[model samples]
Target: MGVVSVSLLRSSVFWTVDDLQQAAGRPAFAVLTQNAGPLQLKDGVASRRGFEEDLSALHEFITHLPAEFSTPCMMFTSTLPREGSSTIVAAFAAALARAGSKVLVIDGNLHHPSMHEAFGINARVGLTHVLEQHATLQQAVQTVADLPSLHILSAGPVPPDPFALLLSSDLRGLLQSATDRYDYVLIDSPPAGRFPDAFYLASLSNVVFVIAKYGIVQRQPTARLLRKISTPDLLTSGFIVNGALGVSE
Candidate 1:
């Protein structure tokens, strides 16, 4: 399993590529450092230059990946919550949409769903509603005002049992339908090691990308989590190192 590491950097954060290489024991796939304070979207489009540059780089990396990595559905998870996987998923989806590829971003993190806020859309009805048969996919799916190619499916109200809902056959059907309609589907899932939700989601996705906080995430635990969740039916794409800097291109 060859792993590619991507470093997401903040302006003030400073760490060397060697630091990450030593920690992950893998070469870097791409280095994306942004001085932009936070992701800012205007009219459902990336407003900040730095953020746009980073997204462009990420999109380039994904496009250049091996032919086997080309898939309609991709899931992004992290070693733990708040590692910035959700932001990456959103940015990547927007990048795809800007390139004229229809993209759907699913907020699979039912426990602490926030993708709705990112896109400035309503989350009152979404994946949960669809899974529970409370709403149809068309009713729950939201389109970005300006970015017509981009769509979002928020987590909706927190379900009583998120794991149970994710495991339902309805979830599979939803993904299948999404893949049929969209050129790409990006799912933002919960932390892998902290919850079983990521594992189950990974099985349903064609490719899984684990996001690890550069300094905070430990190698052994991350490695173990990858091993536990990986299956022959799924492709574990690689690692995305969040919050670090100073890497040669």
Candidate 2:
């Protein structure tokens, strides 16, 4: 997310906002609104619609993500959730749709999930149900509107054993299933210090990319924690600094 003016979506003149933002030395992946509010046009304040500028930039961003990584597995973390991992992952999925890639965004942050909220999906049935083996894939998967190729599986009601579920064989099978169904599986995991659920999932991913805030403290013990996750196969490791909250903000 980044500063956004909905009206700018309609103007070919504003198409280069991506380059401008990237030039600012802090490029962002924006989850812009579908509606561009009233703006000055020849017919007076008019709504802007049918523009793909923001979405196109987002597509470029997520499409190149896997290619940039050393492995297919990607681990994303935030110094904390408020720092922006969920937003990034969800938007990344949305943009991935634009890039002609079929993507499934799993809300792996069980303690307090946000994928459903970001996508405006019902939180009653999803990955939680699937992991519990209580729901079929069709019953759990929700298609993102306006983004035909992007699907979301939110972590439903927080289960008592999110960690156990992370290590469940069912999860592994699900990942395998996803690999065959989609181009990429983007998971929105929890903060490193908040829980170890993500660590377990990261081990299964092709690559793991971490997330750090522009400025935040990670109180977790570094060496011991790193040791627990040590693995030669873990690749495509990187960190992103995010601060934006909403498109209009």
Candidate 3:
């Protein structure tokens, strides 16, 4: 299946909607036209200028979403780890919060949780604790000091079997509770190609975005992952191309 949309981030070389349309062989539904620089955060607040154009594009995309999806919950995953999916999630969530939307970012990457560190919060009491009934949702969710509208639920301690933990009923409950409270809920999951966790998370999200590092990520695996996760109920909003050198004709 063809991609429904495409977002580019931190490209070392420039790219335009025309360039991406030529590369994808179809018009993009929404494209982040600017070359986003590395995400900059000072005391947990994202720099507006660093992601302004990207944020504008994202806002435009969200604004055009179907009306039924009033409080959309989105997930970000990649073909492989360290493909900058986490950074993308963080930047986008921060942008939403800065724009006065109450946003919650869940560090669903149970095996490798970095959202806590990214937001300068304690990871000890988070999603795992809430899932296990050791902590309440209120307790596990931490508010970012600099960005009051932003909240985070870190993955907490790494579990013996991250996938098994994700299977618990509490995850759905947590998501339900989150959607009831936040304007947007963004989840960060492990690499979709290497783990089933991403698929599971995709099933629970309103929209899914696969992150692919430009030069490092191969097309076959990424395409395979996208095909596997796309479904009628879930809007597989296509993928983000990160750190690209340049687009070739």
Candidate 4:
């Protein structure tokens, strides 16, 4: 099953109008599309000078992922607080939408979720409410008004025990349901050292995207996290070295 389903490039869902439409801001809408007339990523701005080349690499990377991940890849990303995991996660998601995949980005960092703020989405209801109140994931999810293929699940409100909330029977079920519906699930998790949320996501996600700044990913927590996960199949999806934006002098 893993080998036959792992190729993202071969999936019919990866190339369709429905994928882009779903990503057009419905967090629960998990279709990163390639079959539309022509895909156009809407929400965020792409880096003009280097975006094309950058995403070329990213696209190659995503499509080449292990064949077992083809059914729908589950990748959760996080970092130490202030490591810019949000920036990287959002960028990668936007890129996926541009390429033609139905993408659902759920802000799982309940303690401090910024998905709403980044997209200018009004979070009247978010993950917290969706899980606690048994609300519809579609209702809490908002469409990226201008972006054709981008959806987000905002962190609705702070929960008393965020760990229990994320690992809740219902929320986990929702995540499972999401996999069958979307092409890629890029979850934004809290810093590994600071909370248990990362652990929860690490346990369930097929892959983990670890973001460490130029100098900040020390040996302690990262090693600890790697050890904590402790499974060969459970892998680090990617390592993003961030915070090198510069002024071309």
Candidate 5:
């Protein structure tokens, strides 16, 4: 019943995490991917099948994440523009919230903010306001009626110096405060290899999830970028390939 099913057709079409684990002897990512159909993006949100697949993949990834962290702040990033990191973070955050986790999504990509656009909300105030002391987190946080547990911190008005703002001590304090209040803090940062802002956010987060768009992300540069940001304390949750197997680029 519900979304869970023992039947193969229902299981593959809806969800069958238990059956997947029993059948595949591996994680749910591969199984979900196999069952996923083509996806279309409308207003920055993935189609149903694609969204479900991404949610399952990310959920499985989080399930395996070490339980040592009491409050996990995960940053989703990519090596280049148009890598679908923002879309993934948005959908992933919503999925987490729907599953009863309190998730705070911080739009750290000040250069080209997309959370407001994706959620169709006016970005009158956001992270910049909080960092600049113009607004408190409670004031900056925007909530959607449908997703009660998910909150968004838009990039606010794009500042003249985004890098400077992101590196500010206030930003660090905000991250700490957010992690304390929320079950998971999902940060959508600028491209990893192209912008220093991503590295800064990644340093502050306990987990880093890299998105590599198929065909768009070259192997060598991504490798170099990963090595550059690699840290012992940071939990790099490995790469998630966007547009995997004939999906749009």
Candidate 6:
């Protein structure tokens, strides 16, 4: 077993990467509903019924991860836009933090940056700056006040060349650094069918969670999207049928 370090952050517990690796596997894909408006994390607590249910489900999923995914670094994307993938990814991070694990959520969807807004933080400096060499990793990460164990690297200023930045070598370095620092790193990527960026991000992930909104994403297209990404053979994959559990949209 790897070296495990555990610390109590106020009422919540925080664990080091070694601890998570030895304790259990990564979480499974979860299908959650999209809030009609926004997810408010006042004091780092999620209050909505749907949100709480989803968080609990995610916590349950963590116990059954495969051996290969014990130290999971994964990405979440959808077949189409507005499928509630970003929201699910955010909830997953919160769930991990609540479990007393150090979590890092990176906004890799440069096309639509929402992680910063979700956490109510300034997106002035993040992955973009770090990739461009304008800022260091320490400068780009924003620590959540309510969840001391959760850190966010928002998608900074919209670059004119989004793909170029994502494909840059800097991203690989940053990702490696994150792996060493955080117990789990969840990246929120853009829709797979709409942009190629998701493919690139998925390549770096240990597992990929594809979200398909019920009544929104058709079955045909979802199958096609899955087939399209199977070329390199994704490390591990799962589906989150949004609204499938009768959660409000």
For each of the candidates, the C-alpha root-mean-square deviation to the true structure, in angstroms, is 6.6, 11.0, 6.5, 14.1, 10.4, 13.8
**Cα deviation of 242, candidate 3, in Å:** 1.3
Task: By lDDT, rank the candidates, best first.
Answer: 3, 1, 5, 6, 4, 2
Better-scoring candidate (lDDT), 1 or 6: 1
Reference-based lDDT, each prediction = 0.73, 0.59, 0.74, 0.60, 0.72, 0.71
Best lDDT among the predictions, by candidate number:
3
Over 106-173, each residue of candidate 1 has an lDDT whose tens digit, in order, gives 99998888788888899899899999999988899999998999999999999988998878747888
Local accuracy of candidate 5 as per-residue lDDT tens digits, 46-149: 44555566568578667676777756899888788887778787777777888899999999999999888777667989999999999999999998667888
lDDT of 6 by residue, 115-139 (tens): 9877888898988888899888888
lDDT of 6 at 149: 96
Q: What lDDT does candidate 5 reach at residue 12?
A: 34
TM-score of each: 0.81, 0.66, 0.83, 0.72, 0.80, 0.79
- Sort by TM-score, best first: 3, 1, 5, 6, 4, 2
Per-residue lDDT over 1-249 for candidate 2, one digit per residue giving the tens place of the 0 to 100 score: 233654433331212324323323333344333322222222221112422444455445544664544114345665445655665566556655666877888888899887787777789998889987899766898987867898888889998888887777488788777767778788888886678887787787765545433323232332233434546666534334343223232
Score residue 234 of candidate 3 by CA lDDT. Answer: 86
Model 4 vs. true fold: TM: 0.72
lDDT of 3 at 65: 83
lDDT of 5 at 94: 76
Instruction: Report the Cα lDDT for residue 177, model 3.
Output: 90
Worst 10 residues of 5 by lDDT: 31-40
On TM-score, the leading prediction is 3
